[model samples]
Target: MDESNNNIKEPEKRAFLKGAGLSIAALLVGGLSIERYAVPKDRSVPVMDNFPLAILEDPSGQPVTTSEVIEFAGAKTTTTSSPILVFNYPLQDEPTFLIALKGVKITTPNTPPSSGFAPVPSGTDAPMDGIIYDSTTNTSILAVSGICQHLGCVPPFLDYHPGQSVPFESELIGYKLNGAGVKKWPDYGLIYCKCHGSQYNPVWGGRNLYNNGPAASPAKHSLPQIMLATDSNGYIYAYGINSSNAVIRTHLNFPGGETYGSGVKSEDLTGGTAIRQSTRSLPANLSLYKNTTLESVAPSSLGTNQSSGAIILYKTTVVSNENKNGLNWKGTF
Candidate 1:
């Protein structure tokens, strides 16, 4: 995406030489107090060990500057419900698409995640243009690959109801690993691939086969989550993609073969080094990756009557992120 980092005049690149110290595929449990009580499952984000200083590069392989906000604002021509738009990023193959899920409700916690980006949904309608700075529900824009995870086929966005739109193979029946890396089935209506009926979460991490697809396939069941970053001026950047339970299907000829069982563990096909499982992740962790830098922005209302921190008023889809204790921490490192 050819975005201009014009909104916020940044000072300079804030780089760290050392750990400054501490960090995702699923939280590095070596440290950090793992709360034993029944906390909100989304809060159990993976705290990586490495710093989030990764360089964010666009598809052209150019270093993404803070001014990239210009492009993000330009991409949204109109605020259509669940509009599927593209942000040319990573350039690994193609630009990532930021699909807007109009009505699906997700959980939004009271406080911002210490990491910044968490699976919190503002539960508000997405702006036609520009990123919605939501400190509350946290998720408003979900960036993902337009390609289907089944066989890299480009899929169509369908209406959830049958007959009016394309019919699904059946009621979505599938399961995926949650933040805790536990497998369970979840239903994210409407956003399903017409190509193979592979349903996924239109928001958050863009899970693959949250309902099982095909007779039986293998892998961590994840679609690539386009890593999203926002600037101080309410700009959303598609810098990279995130994938999990990485595996390479080399020999489909021998699906049951012993050698085929232990396929290759490939690194992410994204341009950015840092990875986040879902929006519930601490956005700050992304800054720890090298090559890129992110300065957290407070929630800013888009071009709406509602004011800052008042997103709840204009909310159409409210994703609740309630903590077990029901307290709002300052939510910072």
Candidate 2:
């Protein structure tokens, strides 16, 4: 976790408050709506004109580079064994959960056929379902999509403890029930949806037991795994994701089920059914995008707070017109 930078130190911490809402139009170079953007006068980098791109003179725009390493304790601040840590970037839309699993048993750090682990959803034989490491403390980080598939609810990162109601317990973890009406879990690795009790396993990375919930298909709902990269200096960078094109504008879609879709705040209902959900590890997802698309970028320095990595937003599209700050593309539960 080296904080020493080869480059010169930037100015003091800067605050750039990004609008949490996404308009129908993306960030175009000129106006709010991009339908009538001016064509570039110059002929060089023609495709670069396609995106309304912005670059920082310094890391002035980065949000997570501070020295604020969110510690293990939560609202209580007492010692506890909560399974995961959630870093919420309210400014970013769609699938907004940055989860770090606290004590997941890792038989291997490199790849799988992982011992003491279940099968994580992947397209190939070698499944590197998402798992990162704080090698310093041996903690595994799971920066999973918070948007639930059965419905879009930001499930809590909670410890599983019986005989304790969710509200009375200050453990920062939850004890939500599954489809089978079971609330007592044998482990603490569940990202339990409060809306409809859609339970997803971060331990196995992108594992969904639809039989455990009321998802239409067998294991249809899966948490979207985020892509992350880290320099030897302990900087974890999130650049991409493998998620469903499914749009969930409201969480009321599947009410009364193991999970329900209800409007998080004032989000309008957008139309798109989830095809499937699966979790792929950061390394695996990165490889999939790279191998298939063969994209590359020259190296450049990004200013970061060093506490967390600012999300590297590669793409975003407005899906619903319900509110001024409409929802962006989201994953199925």
Q: Looking at model 2, which ten-residue stretch has the lowest summed lDDT?
A: 49-58
Predicted candidate 1 versus true structure: per-residue lDDT over 1-333, tens digit per residue: 101211113222111101112111012443332111111122223222111212333333333333332233223332112323333223211224454433323332233233312333554533211222233333245555444444333323212221123243333433232335433323233345433455554443334334333223322244555455554333334432342322221112223421211131122222221221111221232221112222343222111111132311100011111211222211111
State TM-scores per candidate: 0.36, 0.41
Runs off by more than 4 Å, candidate 1: 1-80, 92-95, 102-139, 155-188, 212-220, 243-333
Which candidate number would show the highest TM-score if scored against the true structure? Answer: 2
Question: What lDDT is reached at residue 232 by model 1?
Answer: 33
In candidate 2, which residue ranges exceed 4 Å CA deviation? 1-70, 73-91, 105-130, 155-183, 209-219, 243-333
C-alpha lDDT values of all predictions:
0.29, 0.30
Instruction: Name the lDDT value of residue 196 in candidate 1.
Output: 40
After TM-score superposition, what is the CA distance of residue 38 in candidate 1 from its true location, in Å? Answer: 44
lDDT of 2 by residue, 205-301 (tens): 5343223322322124566455444433334444333322122222222233233122222121122111111121222122112222323232122
